[model samples]
Target: MENPIFKDMLVLELASVLAGPSVGQFFAELGANVLKIENAATNGDVTRNWKLTTEPADTDIPAYFCAANWGKKSLALNFKEKEELQQLYKLVQQADVVIASYKPGDAEKLAVDYETLRSINPRLIYGHITGYGAADDRAGYDAVVQAESGFMYLNGEPGGGPVKMPVALMDILTAHQLKEGLLVALLRRERTGEGQLVEVSLLQAAVSALANQATNYLVAGQEPKRMGSDHPNIVPYGSVYTCKCGKQLVLAIGDDRQFRKLCTILGAEGMAAIPAYATNYSRVQHRQEVNERLSQLIGQQDREGLLQQLQAQHVPAGAIYTIPEVFAQPQAQEMLLRNGDAKPGVRQIAFKVQHQEQAQLTPPPSYNNYKEDKID
Candidate 1:
């Protein structure tokens, strides 16, 4: 296997929870030496205490903490202490990159703001994550941002109360944005020999993620509504059909050709010839009628046979799977990782990169797991 891309890079992670630490985790996976700094006064990252299951007999580390913090060293310090603050400053001086997720003015209060640290190390790439905009002082948790950014308003069934996504989608999207920005900054620093500040907010990320839904309202003057599992623009694209055996399958008929194939398979050649459903645009205009016809036809067929026939006909279709069913697939097994054979062992990184040696998975540390070594 080849060596990792960022073997010699050093990252100082002053982040907690999901978004900021996730960026550090990405660097760590690429073989960067990431030192995660947590405040000793607060028992380290808040996620360390966010227990999903009861504390195991062997480890007090929460699964939430483990998910985003692996393959990194931990240094816990009280910033209020003169000695510890000095030590942290020294670490900043040696780092190639620094990432933090503090509410509005908290970074300056702790003396870890980008401007202060940049003065110490001119070539240091700094990344800042916020809940709202850089100047907004409101707390920017994922759910709140989702609600504020119009994401929640577009979610859930028609005529039902808005529902927040079960996952921290805004945080995850922000992490990706931060990761991309930092990588670009790192590349630019190599050429210019000067680092820059990169910033991402949960609100910004949520808004950008609006994609076509946002465009529908802005460009077409069509405000979107909750359509449950259906896509706003595409007809039959997000509808889940129940088979005779009670299994659910989702169809994604992208074009007229795929629609015609689907119609042929369902013995609805006459439906396919109808002018109202002849093209994707027309079908979208008559989505209820199209969906009703497809649902009635598909509901009579067995899922496995229907899916096999759909695949053979080049129609995009898939069975709706539960979480366990998804994990049971070979593709999913290849993506998931486990540290050891123990029952509640460390959940390894869920992504993979080809042609690189797998990094050794490290369990998330307890508070102040590593003592500060004097920086030269």
Candidate 2:
């Protein structure tokens, strides 16, 4: 077989929980030999027992850890130990990259910071994922960053207090950005053979992921308001109507053409003549009016009928499918939302990578089981 893209890569991960370890996992999936070094006292990454399950054994199985920590070799070491520190320095010398999310002063205190590690290996790519930017002294957490970045401000219904997301979206987003930074540094090294530092802060990453919302705020001086599943710039562009079948349909009419098509399909062509609803800009201005009209028109239609009507008009529309419905969806399964067999008998439910093969979803390893390697 051909060699993997990251065949020459070796990563030393001193990260706990999601963000930093997630960076290592991505590299490992790309064929890097990633070694995740955790503290022995912690026993392993604490995400191991986060999720509660019915079976008692499953709790200890660390299903949470299994999500993003696959394909990595685990080693437990006490950084405070002189011998362990020495061994870690040696490992750094041989590694192509070092991933860490230690607090600002903590890495230097432990002597594992990139500044210290770079002295041992000039070609090592040092990946630092932190809560806030290095320049800012503020510490970051998912909810706090969400609030600070103005993301939470626009998350819920209009007039509702900001609600944090159910998942660590900002954290996961930072992981992906960190991976990109690492890969960029790795590519740069291919030419200069000189390693560099790569840093991703949760706060900045979350702000970046806000995309146009942030742009509108900064450029257009518009404060983003929560529309409560409604579109800010277009009418009929959110959870439009719930059907008799108890399903919610998200309707998106992007432009005037699509809006006209929707009007025809819903048998409300007269709505097209409304001066305030005639253009995208006007529709946005009178979003409340449009929503009320559209709701009245489609509220009585069953989900199946609405889908057929909307789709036939070539309007961008879809049902807000439940998590279960997504799995049952032929297209979603075909694209491999559920993936991997790294754990032999245990199934792996990995995130889908676009245009790529399934991830190596191995079972979460026993505490420090990977330390029996030749490197140690």
Candidate 3:
């Protein structure tokens, strides 16, 4: 969070949950002054109550709420209050950006939609996120969106029931999409001297992220099936192999050469010599045979030793690390963001840039923690 490129900029956050809050946090991490305006009537974001049994029942700052709320000043307001509405408008007059996730018409009802806010400050950038598109108002939860967008259909093992992803995948994807759009909007404002609204929806983000999988159906008339971790286009790629210590490793062999190299490492060079398994296409055709043989060979070795061997040989393979193990790694230390007594959050901006030296990041605020008094 040392990058101060957004220093002195003001961002008003009218969003809650993951996507919009994440966008606000992105600017906050980059040193923008972000104000998170929450609904006081409901006791702030719904995620504040999403906690494990281990978390304190009395606290408003649950770990889930902290996921994207870091480095923000919170002001909880009941929108029905006229004085509070005027207070928000006063701040909006000076704000550079506003990030919101009010479904379709909620913003208009609250008199805080893009048109209203832009009238107060023509230079204000508006970023909005939705469950579906701007028109469809059906609640767009990640699990339901995954089902609608074909992700659930193609995610699990072959012949098993469709499964939703563990994380809020659609929200995360939409957050990234909104960030890209808002950055572009900022650049556009630099040239036009006028701000514009940038909108992204969970359904749009999820569908667009299908990438090659969608092309397989549209261009080639192929219906993608659930193949577990295996890739349909690449032989021996995305294949999960188990080792002696019960550790799982995944391979990402890119081409015939890598497949041959993998075969040599597995003591199965003879398999590569056979016409049915010699090339990527052939190996893909005879995938069951290839996988069975490779599985048997891999199951005999220790995970750490084999992982080292693969790395030394420049093979594209990786351990299936648990969540705790991922953050425990030395390289992941750089991504850590500590904020007061709350559990640490991760940095949203992954890229590095030279900026002013950073002070410690502030933790996600409690409901109405800063109120309107903190605003200039």
Which of the numbered candidates is closest to the native, going by highest TM-score? 3
Q: Write the per-residue lDDT of candidate 1 for residues 34-108, one digit (tens) a residue.
A: 888988899788887788556764454677777788767889888889998988899887899999998889989
Q: Give per-residue CA lDDT, model 2, range 1-376, as digits (tens).
A: 3445676678989987778877877777666777889888777777876876654665544556766676677788998899989988888878999999876788888999988999999999999887887776666687888888887888888878888888788888898898889889989999999999999999889978988787778888988898788867667777558766777788877889898888888888989878999999998898888888887877767888878977877889998877779767865565332236443222222454455543443445566767553542
Each prediction's total of clashing residue pairs, residues at least 3 apart in sequence or on different chains, is 0, 0, 0
Model 1: how far residue 128 lies from native, Å: 0.2
Best by lDDT: 3
Task: For model 2, state the Cα shift of residue 236 in Å.
Answer: 2.1
Q: By lDDT, highest first, what's the ranking?
A: 3, 1, 2
List lDDT for all candidates, in order. Answer: 0.85, 0.78, 0.88
* lDDT comparing candidate 1 with the true structure: 0.85
lDDT of 3 at 123: 98
Steric clash pairs (candidate 3): none
